[model samples]
Target chain A: MTSILETENSDNQTQKEITLIENILKKTGPSYTKYILGIGSVLTACLTIWLGLFITPKDEHLGNTVRLLYVHPPVAWAALYLAFGTTTLASLLWLWPKTRSYFWDKIAGASAEIGVLYLALTLVTGSIWGRTTWGVWWTWDARLTLTAVLLVLYIAYLAIRQLDGSDKTKANRNAITALFAAIDVPIVHFSVLWWNTLHQTASVLTPGLHLTVPLSMGLTMGLGFLCTTLIWGWMMKVRYDIELLKVVDSEIELQRAIMQRRNEP
Target chain B: MTTNERLLKRRKLRIVIVLAILLVIFGALIYEGLTNSIEYFETASQAVANRQTLGTSDFRIEGNVIGSTIKRKNEETLFSISSGKTVVPVISNGSPPQLFQPGIPVVLVGHFAKGNGPGGTSLLFLSSQIMVKHTNQYIAAHPNRVKIVKN
Candidate 1:
């Protein structure tokens, strides 16, 4: 009688365990929220392109090249401030023993990969605009040179993450490298002010937060900013999902290896 | 070691060496580039003040175009740029960019002419290229401005 009662209790316990696992799996899997964000990003990008190309007036001075303002500045802001800023904060969190987690390290790595994409876009778009307006495809001015350096630095940061190491060692290395690369962000920002560079200073983000550009141009640029940021957000979610899968797969593999060893013994 | 193990070891060593060399090259390039770009250009006033010391050296000068002084001749465009009270006469070898106009700032890349100025009162800058230096401000094309541009 006692054995039968114990077996019933064990069955109940297994049922509870299964329910818990199901809840976790549901949480980790993709949901409607990510898809909704992805759709929003696509729609906003289309709207930005439409308004930038057609609705906005040609700049009094820049003419049609003014349309590039929508592309270059927004991409640059996303790359330099948004993506790298997230990586820096996440790296700091990982470096802090109290807050250290694989979550932060994975976020840093994912954000940096996206940062590289936006940085390259920033360079390409800016180059096209420069050729039309500034009469050069590239120059060795302070701002341009520093921006190029920032790209190389982040590329190196990503490469460092690929080296063979234990998880802890890799995380530590990545976190440190991210912090080192982030030192260039402020320098790139202030280069125009500190040196004689061909690149112009901020338009909307001036010293007093004054809007230098006209209202229409400013609003279109703001929309472009929103579009790029939304795209970054959607990309981050997808990247984080992939990173979580890798972590989960490794955990499972480790468990399977231990089980096989136990069965052999 | 087995052949496979030896091959893997050789590959790892090769990667390490390549990475080390790349790191050194990158470091040197950044150092040199940063040092050179620190003072990328001089203002018209600054360039004029240092003309004696900067004789015939290739550099860039930044200034605003004096509206009344732009003139074009065969294969050359001539303009005067000013920063504060110092105005530098520029003789550019080619056509300026599309946006280049009076009252706009520009960065001219070249050096001081070998000889004296037009009247021998000041030096002339011989420019190989002209880059329009736009400000951050953006003004929409007003109706009046559009008509003016068309007329």
Candidate 2:
């Protein structure tokens, strides 16, 4: 019958698509480069911890609490600048007419997931530092408040991605939501300057570019930045692989269903 | 409906509920921040200018401590904080923090005094707490060079 032949043809097409997706997945699986990045992240992180805890001299004002500077600022940079910045950039690329691709969407999602982890660390480390230096565990200051809002905004972005929709529809929704969330980044950065805040302004990244920190502390903090960025890179590569695997997994499931139907009486 | 369709519908419902909760939390945070922490504290000069309007209500004032003016009487610590030309005398009920010193910036939480003390000062602010507000500048204390940190 014509209907039976049509169904057979559809199954054949699905089989071909599955074959193609499987090939792509095989080519894109974990590689030597990812392993190198993983090793580098671990080694650099250990070195940073050693230098921060032992080698870094006591700050004249902050004393032993100055060690937190190495952790807090680097984690903040990774979250606010490195990871979130990548998400916004990837989202922008996906929104562009010429560069629109699911690749950008996946990259945005992965970067954002990692960014949330780093942002949470930023808040935790900052709170510990705040308690020791500022004499309070928490305060409703502008910088702290806006940073909290930034975390919530990104949380909403991740939730929006979970809404049931077609791939294209989800991509569009995520891109727009990421763009909107990015509006808060600059506001959070300038909150101390724009408003009366208990939080101190930027120590190193001041307008004049003078290193507010000493040479030894600055170098250790720089190493911390490198360590965090490498960790982010390794995580991003693995997360992107997982996204690819999801596509392959769904294809395999469809292939199995088709074979089962063909075998049915 | 098929089992797949039912599962999809349930998942979507869960996501929607989560999104609603997040939305409410976000709204509450913004509202709380706008009213309470947006304007963190008034400076010493501003607080003095608006003392009558502020009345006995709890508020925070930021200023630099005048070291020479700091005095301890009984259990109370008395000090004068200045912003520009305006100086506000403060009487704290308890001992100040370890880092509390002259020429350092601090934020004091309290209200305008309802009455002049035994010394009969015309203007005085009653402080319940004092918090040292350090600056962004850092001068490394070299063993050879004695570094003076100015906030």
Candidate topping TM-score = 2
lDDT of 2 by residue, A205-254 (tens): 77887888888889988999999999999999989888887887787788
Task: Write the residue-wise lDDT of candidate 1 on A124-189 in tens digits.
Answer: 999999999999998888888888888878887887787666899999999999999999999999
Candidate 1 backbone collisions, by pair: none
Off by over 4 Å in 2: A1-25, A28-30, B69-77, B93-98, B115-122, B143-151
What lDDT does model 1 reach? 0.86
Collision pairs in model 2: none
> What would the DockQ be for model 2?
0.56
* Positional deviation of residue A93's Cα in model 1 after best superposition, in angstroms: 0.6
